[model samples]
Structure formats: structure tokens, C-alpha cells
Target: MHIRRICESEGDAAGTLWDHMCRETGDGRPLTERARRDVSRMLAASAWHRDAFCLVAVHPGGRLAGFVNGRISTGDGLLPGLLGEIEALYVVPGDRGQGAGRALARAATDWLVAQGARTVRYLSCAGAHDDHRFWRSLGFEADMVCLSLYREP
Candidate 1:
């Protein structure tokens, strides 16, 4: 798999992958139209932002196998210096374990480091054993756990 920065023309393809990620990891609800638009806007912004990026892993046949979006920002009051976050990462089911995910993550991390990030972090889905193991293998340790409560209107 070849990894590179995502191009402007590939926005739709990235959106499709984002939907797949949401479906696979989310609470079984499809993304609302507003949510989809919001993601599209975010992706567009990443492409133009110096401190943010989206990288895509392409199959030999020119298909996108996966993508990872990351950004650099000031850490919360507790942590000092700039922080790098792997905002989202998703690989097509068929492409899993073929190094696309790792390559994407590596590329993003490298970019973040180049941009002066002091530390890199990512949030994995709770109870996602495989996902946890994958990040751990990459030397990422659990720094914190986030809990949320949602109520239907």
C-alpha cells in the first residue's frame, strides 16, 4: 500500500470511508446529514491547515484502503507544549492487517512530530480489544479514559 496526503479530488471517497468507520464503531446509527456535512467541512479544513492533515493509504489498484486524520494543538492546562492527536483512523475491512493502518498512523505521527508536537495521543473505542492492542503495539500507552452519557430527546 502507498500512503500519501489526501488530495482535494478525493473528498467523496474519504467521506465514504468516514461513514464506514462511524457505522463500524458507533452506536449502530447512521450519520445524520448534518453530521456528514460537519465531517466534510473538517476534512476540507485539514487539507488547508498547516497544523492538521489527512493521509490516505492507497491500494495498488488506486483504491483508498484507509485514512488517518491528525492535528496539533495546545494541550489542556495540565499538559504542557503542543499535543498531537490522531483524531480518526479507519481501514477498510478487507485491508486490515495488511500494514495500511500502520503506515497511515506512522505517516501522521511523523508529520505531527515534524510540526513540533511534544506528545502524540489517540482515543480508542471502549472495549475494543484489538484496537487497543494495535495502538499499544505502536508504543501508545493508555493515558486516560473518557466516559460519556447520552440521553435521547
Candidate 2:
């Protein structure tokens, strides 16, 4: 598979993949209309953000197999230096384990390092053992944990 930045014409494909990812992660049966719109806005804004980018892994036959979105920014007040974040990463079920995810991640992290990032981070669902392993294989170590509580209306 070949990896490269996503093109303007491929927005819908990327959005579809994003929706799939959301569902797989248990976000919604089908993403709410507002959620879909939010994702579209984020993807559209990526092209204009110099510090952010979205990359796609394409099959030899020209089908998109996966995508990763990354960005570089100043760390929150407690931390120093620039930070690189892997905002979203997903590989089509059939394409997992074939290195598309790795290639996309490597490219995004490399770009962030080139832009002077001092650290790279990705947030996986707390209980996602497989996802955790995939990132660990890439040299990422857990440095933080986030706890959340939900309240019914």
C-alpha cells in the first residue's frame, strides 16, 4: 500500500471512514447529524491548518485502505515545548495488520518531528487492549490516563 496526504476530492471517503470509526468505538448506532457535520468541518479545516494534516493509505488498485490525522501544537500550560498528536487513526477491517496504519502513523509523526515537535501522543480508548498494543509496538508508552463520569439529564 502507498501512503500520502489526502486530496480535496477524497473528503467524502474520509468522512465515511470517520463515521465507521465512530460507530466501531461505540459512539452512535449511526452518527448524529450534528456529529457528522462536526467531522466534516474538522476535515475541511485540516487543509487550511499548517500545523495539521490528514494522510491516507491507498491500495495498489487505488482504493483507500486507511487514514490518520495528526497535528502539532503548544503543550497545555503544564508541559513545555511543541507536542504532536495523532488525532485519529483507522484502517479498514480487511486492511488491519498489513502495515497501512503503521505507515500512516510514521509519516504523520515524521512530519510533526520535522516541524519541531518534542513529543508525540495518541489517545486510545481505556480498555482497548489491541489498540494499546499496536501503539506500543510503535514505541509509544502510556504517560497519562483520563477519567470521565457521565450524568443523565
Candidate 3:
């Protein structure tokens, strides 16, 4: 298996992967009406591309097995100058246990660290739902918990 960072040339592939991730999510909210406006604004963004990163894992036959996306920021002061937080991660069911997820994660985290991130945070909400064991096996420990309070508009 091979893992690598995504580039502009792979926009379609990345978009497809993102679509798959969204579809796999149980969340019911559709894309927001404001998303178009957000995209217009994001088109003018320079740091968005620089701060954001993605890693993709390919199977032996060159099929995309999984991917990870995240950004390195100053939030939480976990690392040094930048803290890496994983925003999304997904692996096809058939690809599980083959190290695709791990390879993707390692690539993303390595890039963040190379960019001077002192801390890496993997946001596993709902207390690790299904892959807690996988993360624990990777040597990650929970140092803090985030609680959310939402109000219906």
C-alpha cells in the first residue's frame, strides 16, 4: 500500500472521497444553503489550502482505500507552533484491518509535524464509537474531553 498527500491535480478524486465520507455519515443534515456563499468566499482564501492537508491510502491495485483530512492550527497548544487536528477519516469496510487508515493517518500527522506542529489531536467524538481499539493501539491517549451544547434554530 502507498500513502501520499493530495494535490490540486487530484481535486476530483478528493471531492469523490469527500462525497463518500459524507454519504457514509449517519448525520442527516443536508448541505447548508450557505454552502455556496461559503465556497465563493473560500475561493479567495489563501491560507485555507496552506493550512489544510489530506492524505490518501491506495491499495495494491491502486484503488483508494481510505483518507484523512485535518489542519494544523494554534488551537489548544498541544504541539509547538501548530497543533494538528484530524477533521475526518474514513476507510472502506472491506479495507479495514489492512492498515489503510493507519497509513493515511501517519501521512497526515507526519506532514503536520514537518510543518512544525507540536501536538496532534485526533477528534474522536462519542468516545471512539467503533474504532477505539485501533486508535488505542496507535498509542494515543485521551487528555481532554470536549462537550457540546447545541440549540435548535
Question: Model 3 has how many clashing residue pairs?
Answer: 3
Task: Write one digit per residue (lDDT tens) for candidate 1, span 3-109.
Answer: 98887767677877898888886475567878777776677667677888999999888899999998898978467778999999999999997888899989999
User: Model 3 over residues 16-130: C-alpha lDDT tens digits?
Assistant: 5555555666772334436534432332231247887767677677677777777878996544577877777778778888778887877777888898787777877674566
Tell me each candidate's TM-score: 0.89, 0.89, 0.75
lDDT of 1 at 99: 89
Residue-wise lDDT of candidate 2 within 1-153, one digit each (tens)? 898878766767777888888888755566787877777667656766798888889988878898899889997845678999999998999998788889988988887888888899999889889889989999999999999999999
Off by over 4 Å in 2: 26-28
Q: Determine which window of 10 residues in candidate 2 has minimal summed lDDT.
A: 40-49
Clashes of each: 0, 0, 3
lDDT against the true structure, each candidate: 0.85, 0.84, 0.67
What's the CA RMSD for each of the models? 1.9, 1.8, 4.0
